[model samples]
Target: MGGGLTLDGLNRQPQIGNTRLQAPIGLAPFNSGMFGQDGSIGTDGLSFYRSFCNDRLGLLCVGGLAVAAAGRANRSSMCLDRDERAHGLRLVCETAHAAGVKVAVQIEHAGRQTGPHETGLPSVAATAAPCPVVGGSPSALSLGEISLIVDQFVHTAEIAARAGADLIEVHAAHGYLLSGFLSAATNTRQDRYGGNLERRFRIVHEIVTRAHAAVGHRIGIRINVHEDLPGGMTPDQAIAGLRNLRTKLAYISISGGMYTRARDVIIPRRTLSRALWRDQAATVRTELGVPVMIAGNIDTPELAASLLEHNVSDVVLFGRSLLADPDMLISATTGRQIQPCTDCGQCKYHTKGYPHIYCPFHPTLRPLRSTWKRRRTD
Candidate 1:
């Protein structure tokens, strides 16, 4: 049913300032630190973003490093050594704010996906089962443990605020702890947190409600509108969940596909279409009465503008696209035809321990310089 509105047509009247962005496009908080081998231990990601964009962009959401930290160490580890985590948060806030971008920290827990050798604690999920990718059987969370996890989300939000983050987004997608609970395929719990869709969504509902109360207007969520898996939460179920959380959330960013299988990671040849999530985003925007952000293989400005023109989403979130070119939004808006990401899967492949992220299309390998020059020249 979607057609018309090319990228050039939308770029004819370019939106420059933050005010111009009806549903502002933004950079995703990718885990550059984890991907890079240096372990520099600061908000290098934020610094990189600021250096590239130069305070022009609004709404910069940091990746869920707090969840990564928690997964790397047990929850008690963070409780025991709050200083390091707090320090990390502080750096992220200062860098992003200094850049004039409203910063939001994504909070997550890997659940059964937790690195076994890293954390040592038994990975926990809504049920006892082996993670499809991580290759470890997780223990089903007890009611007490579930409560603890909820509290952990709240505590993390508090920490994010104290560290000066402008907003907090609960990572309820990508088969993380919250997503694990939300998906019927993953969560087989017989208790209140499982069974029907309502119960299955309780974990997310509780976390969002508590997180909103904990952080107020400064909270949002990145959700998987569809798991794209059999026996999992479908587009319809996800829309219901979004409706339920609308009041509690500041914004709802739509994302899908978990890295549990190779097919889920690669699109077109592997999954349905690269724009599968974009269509789902349109459904979400139609159903939910809140702002919606869409992500997933949206590498072209024309595609993004088409989505925006149709009111598919209030915002477009570019993860690998921005990793390739931080000034992608500016370039597109100003009618500059920049090279789009090829989606070769090299970024994901090299991200495991690569020193820096590079685009196969943009062969220079000088991301910072190229990004800064683009913004500076503009």
Candidate 2:
């Protein structure tokens, strides 16, 4: 491996914080788009993650927890803005921890990707430019506003820590608020928070530094290796930016793309090559000096194992694969037949206003979907 570490087998356990993963495989955070009105995870949300815990995941990342109301990516984005929300969040942690899996709550801010209709606040970003995908002229964040966001991230980290989470994942990918500031394509301010690459990463550096002081190595980060848009965040730029925060992160999850190219890069299709971001992730692990977790079309256990065998990434994160088959980890461990994800658009482009997520190819999920459909109109 890059750090002189060798993976003897795919079943090796990697330690993060006080939890040791059962295996090197983990569940990348997936937002159900079904949070309560205040962005809290209710009983339904707890059940959603609880079901995945029974499947033998090493780490379960509860995702899309907005740091503030103004940062909500959509109407369904969950929040950690209030202390009361920790009750449900703690329940999620307890459920996963009981299943022998560590939990990390993904703290994020959507930036210009959201609008007043969704957050009941004006869209704000690193710049006033309109996002190509979510059309709107967002107000450029002032220096004071930027400082507030950094504080919000710290506050959220405290709540997640108090709620018994093992780790807090800072979301700085997929064209979100922090991602916007890190990219020259989105951030063009002349102040200290912008201009040079170091300046661009200043916001993330500050947040991670402050959060680390509070929670120590309990902080992990997810970031894009490439943003895909012209003039967007590049691999070299991403690596350099991450160099500023690696010491504080427990691990780094490497992913790519933003809202503009979500279909091809973010959710990806069957036509795209498998292990799409493997090379970039490998590069990061080699150069960034931090344990790396990679996701993006890594569908099979064999493929996931190869990435570890070759010293590409420390952990393999499965998004659509686990959704397609919750028993995937069990099958991978026991050499049972693992179900395949057909890359149907049902779980990708179609679940916008839906209350729940279901994989059409999942044998047992069709009836649940039918039940949701019946209730939607009732």
Candidate 3:
């Protein structure tokens, strides 16, 4: 009668790994180099996250920090190793920490997906192959080189840990380096890192286990249960790999598609089935003993809540939806109309050359202003 009311009913506390997220709704890594970095080389990046992170959103998948020079998606992206360039990343972690929001650095290598124009380096992959989108034959990683890349991921996780991140997510999805190794269409090797599920997933398995060994209970994975390529790893194969990695992982987020069929990966067209990976995630939760998260078109709060209620997934993820409205979770909890994502799919295209992720419905992101002279004026 006297105090303020609280929005209830939604399950706010969903535990993933050792970190208990304040809400079941988590912000997927929106885009690398475009949310927080102001003074960095990519000056136009990294503008909205401090406020976005401060919002009711729970998990923050802060991308942009490349594990090593070879992994750099572009020059604008953040690097965890360089102490001088640590400001943007530290700001992200500190901001999330202050808000009691869990943060995970989505450490990834672009692999053959990145072109020389972006990283000033030749594209590399699980094998010396070319993706459907990029040109120039990628240098196949050697055994020693593969070991070195694993070291890079582990070191980056260590950097994230010291930077105050709560978890480390290995980005083995969306046709990245590790994903290539796991896909039959990509990897043609005969070594331990190739062939069947166990061998094909050796790299990711090593990265997750080693990162966990380094960071303890703070390591997880984001992977495609099935790559959309015709000859790629199937859902059955992907599920088998997840089964083995479950013990080593704190949690897993399921995604699909590779670079060739990028639309299938991000689901640009509306005709695709919504919440594409929930079924597989449900299987993971029911059969395997791993906490699973499903991301795709589970846009509305009602649907997200319904999915969680039915035990389809342990966590509900929003990418494009939240990019349109950062406070979608708050609106969902409060029974307000969650802003609908038009799904025009301009955000992904924007990331191709531009340095921002904006909803096609809302194209412009107004930088936060300060009445007092601000540090962002640079």
Best prediction by lDDT = 2
lDDT digits (tens) for residues 99-118 of candidate 2: 88888889999999898977
Query: Each model's TM-score, in the order given?
Result: 0.81, 0.92, 0.87
Model 2 worst lDDT run, 10 consecutive residues:
1-10
Among residues 3 or more apart in sequence or in different chains, the pairs in candidate 3 whose N, CA or C atoms overlap within 3 Å are: 34-46, 35-46, 35-47, 36-46
For candidate 1, write residues 246-315 as lDDT tens digits.
7777777777767556566322232346555777777876787667777777766667677767777767
Q: How many residue pairs clash per model?
A: 3, 0, 4
* Model 2 TM-score relative to the real fold: 0.92
Task: Report residue 341 deviation for candidate 1 (angstroms).
Answer: 2.0
lDDT of 3 by residue, 1-378 (tens): 113323332456877788898877677764444533332422333445654565466788886467776677655555566455566677777767787778877888888888687677778898887878866689999999999999999988887788778878888887888888988888889888987778998888788888888988878888777666667766577678877767678778788777663455555355777777778788767877777777887777667777777777777777778778777777765677766777665566334444445454432353412112321222
| CA-lDDT, candidates in order | 0.64, 0.81, 0.72
Error of 1 at 84 (Å): 4.6
Of the two candidates 2 and 3, the one with more favorable lDDT, higher being better, is: 2
Cα-lDDT of candidate 3: 0.72
* Model 1 ranges off by over 4 Å: 1-23, 34-46, 52-56, 67-84, 265-274, 333-337, 349-352, 355-378
